[model samples]
Target: MLKTFRWAFAVTGLGLVAGVLYDGWTALGLVAVLAVLEVSLSFDNAVINAGILKKLNAFWQRIFLTVGILIAVFGMRLLFPVVIVSVTARLSPPQAVHLALTDKARYQELVTDAHPSIAAFGGMFLLMIFLDFVLEDRETKWLGPVERPLARLGRIDMLSVCVALGVLLVTATTFAVHAHQHGGGHADKAQTVLVSGIAGLITYLIVSGLSDFFERRLADEEAGGHAGQHSEDAGTGRPAVALAGRAAFFTFLYLEVLDASFSFDGVIGAFAITNDIVLMALGLGIGAMYVRSLTVYLVRQGTLDDYVYLEHGAHYAIGALALILLVSIRYEINDIVTGLIGVAFISASFSSSVRHNRAARR
Candidate 1:
């Protein structure tokens, strides 16, 4: 683990020094706090990434480590918020950068003002992932009491979609009511929220659907038979060879989208610690690197197979996170509360797995 995370440690050390050099001890402290916040909030993200990464080809795995890191650190953490401020505040990208540098308060306000749409979109996308995982009938049952019933309900086609849409509608309506009470006197905010939520749902469907389609094609190519003939081998549960070409491409895209969903909370939450975009990027970017390294480490170590319920824990954490994101649209939730809920669920699942392992040993 030390070897795997050596770069993370190094980068974090450098970031702290740079923070101090850039400002002072206060800046360094804030950067450190932001990094810890990101790491705490995203441990489950690493687990989920490993679950997907293990199925990818080694070449693709390398890309995730290399190219994926760039996207995560620079693309999402730095450029994304700038772009959000640009579009929302009607400024060019360069002007957005200037605003971020010249007027941190205005930049932060713009980003925060855009939070509702971001929350709605990310919430819907993540909700779909959790629902699909729990609602699928799988051979392994981590939390059978909860998962078994959900799996049975998965029989209803597109039930997750229906549930997500219903939830979005209710949430949006609640927001509208609150807006009226506050005298915003406009439905545009609610409209934007609904549209963004639908876009997220659509994005999830496209990415996941394409990934599933390509995975089947690749599996068939390897098995030399009709697609789905070797369904079990297609999943990460079984030993599998690397996917080629198009399959690898789609899988990579899927991973990026998944990472984006996980990042939404971190990006928004970072403002709570400090509104300095550069600091936010530096701190969160350091944590992002660690999360990526953790993903690769988990894949290499085969942690999922050893701790059978770990993936269950990660998925359940995701479910909780999704719910939290949705609820945040209606009420303000502290980032710490979000982090603790995820930790609680994942820790319980881990404990359950340990007990299961001990019993089997006997």
Candidate 2:
């Protein structure tokens, strides 16, 4: 464990040192809190990522740890929120950055105010992921009673899409009525939710579809002229071998988008700690580093195969998060509460995995 996390520890130390140098002990304290918040909220993300990372070869895995980490740190942590605010509040990139640096309180307000749309898009994307997993007819069934019926329903073409659209429409309608009653921004938020949710759904379909298409091609090639072999990779739900060429590229894109969806809430919730973009990036960046490292470690160690049910737990946690995000559009949900819900699912799944292992031994 120590060997795997050596880089994370080193970078975390540097971030903490920089935090103290930037603004005394108070900034250091805030950075520590923010890092904890990020890690707590994102452990399940690491699990899901590991399941994908193992499909890539050493080169792409290195890229994930190196280039992917940079994007997660700078692109999502620092720049993405700026872009969101710029689009939402009609400010330019420079102006958004200026507002963040100069008037952090107002900037935080703008970012927070944009939460409905962010939640809509991210919530729908994540819901699709969870729905795909739950709806698939996998050999392993964690929640057999619930998942079994869902798998039967998966026979219906695009059942997951239909379910996702149904949920989005209902949620948007609920929010539209609530916003009308409250007179918050005159129903603009309802429209934003509907638009963003459709965007999210479409984005998921395109990216995921492209990734699966490439993976099928890769799988076909690996099967050696046996085009009738399999529609998708077996076992890991990714390509059988480490993907290369076009396959790796699309899969990598999918992983980044998935990671971004998970980070949406964290970026917004970090304002509860401090609105200083620099400190927020430094702290959450540290946590992201740890999450990336943990993912690589899981891929290297074959932990998922051993645990078996861990993936199910992570997906269930993701489903919970999706619901929470949509619900929070009309009502605020505490960050601590959100974090605990994920941790609970993961813990329960881990315990179940251990029991299954013990029974097999018997």
Candidate 3:
């Protein structure tokens, strides 16, 4: 574990020193707090990433550790927020940078103001992930009480889509409208929210759909005339060496989009801690590195296979996070509440897995 996470620790040390050099101990303190906030809120993200990363080829896994980490740290944490402010504030990219560097308060306000659309999009995308997971026909029931019913309901074709769309529409009309009234009366609250929500749903469908399709193709090639070699590879405790080329690309893209969905809330919430974009990026970037390292550790160690229920807990956490994002369109949920809810679900699932293992030992 220490070997897997050495870089994250190194980065943490370097980032703390850089923070102090950049400002003072107060800046260092805020950076530390932000890093903790990110890790606490995103441990489930690392678990989910591990589940997907294991299926990927080693080459791609390297890419995830390399290029993917760069994207997560700089692309999502820094540039994406700038892009949001640019588009929403009607400024060019350079101008957005200037605004962020110059008028931190205005930049923060614009980013927070754009939260409604960001929430709609990220919420729907994550909701699709959780819905498909729970609705899939699988026997590895972590919470059989809830997952069993969800699986039964999966019998209805397009049920997940229907439910997601219904939720989006209802939310657009209700919470979104209320937001419009309170949120400076944006020209078309329902329209903006509905459109962003649909975009998110479509994104999930395309990215996840293509990834599964390519992976299935890889499995067939490996198994020849038999069933999925993806499963066969898993049974043998080896990655499907063929998860490269197009399959790797889409899987990589899927990971990035997934990271983006996980990051929207965190980026906006960082303003509460400190309005400095550079500090926010530095702090959040350090935390993101740890999540990435944790993901790699989970994959190499096959922790998901050992724990069994850990993935279920992570998905449940995703479901909870999705709902929180959606609800945040109207309400202001504290970062602490968000972090605690995820921790509770993950902790409970870990306990359950421990019990299951003990019973098997008997």
Can you give the TM-score per candidate against the true fold? 0.92, 0.93, 0.93
The TM-score of predicted model 2 comes to: 0.93
Lowest summed lDDT window (length 10), candidate 1 = 176-185
**Candidate 3 lDDT (Cα, whole model)?**
0.88
lDDT per prediction? 0.86, 0.90, 0.88
The 10-residue segment of model 2 with minimum total lDDT is 177-186
Tell me how far the alpha carbon of residue 96 in candidate 3 is from the true structure, in angstroms, after superposition: 0.9
Position 50, candidate 1: lDDT: 95
lDDT tens digits, residues 237-301, model 2?
65444444688988889999999999998998898889999999999999999999999999999
Check candidate 1 and list the clashing pairs: none
Which run of 10 residues does model 3 get worst, by summed lDDT? 224-233
lDDT of 3 by residue, 1-362 (tens): 88889988998999899899998989999999989888998999999999999987678888997898889888988899999989987899999999999998888888888888999999999999999999997878987888888899999999999999999988898888887333456448778889999999999999999998988877665775256344334545545544436787898999999999998878878889998887888899898999999999999998999899999999999999999998898899998999999999999999999999999999
Candidate 2's C-alpha runs over 4 A off are 179-186, 225-243
**C-alpha lDDT of residue 11 in model 3:** 86
Cα distance off (Å), candidate 3, residue 103: 1.1
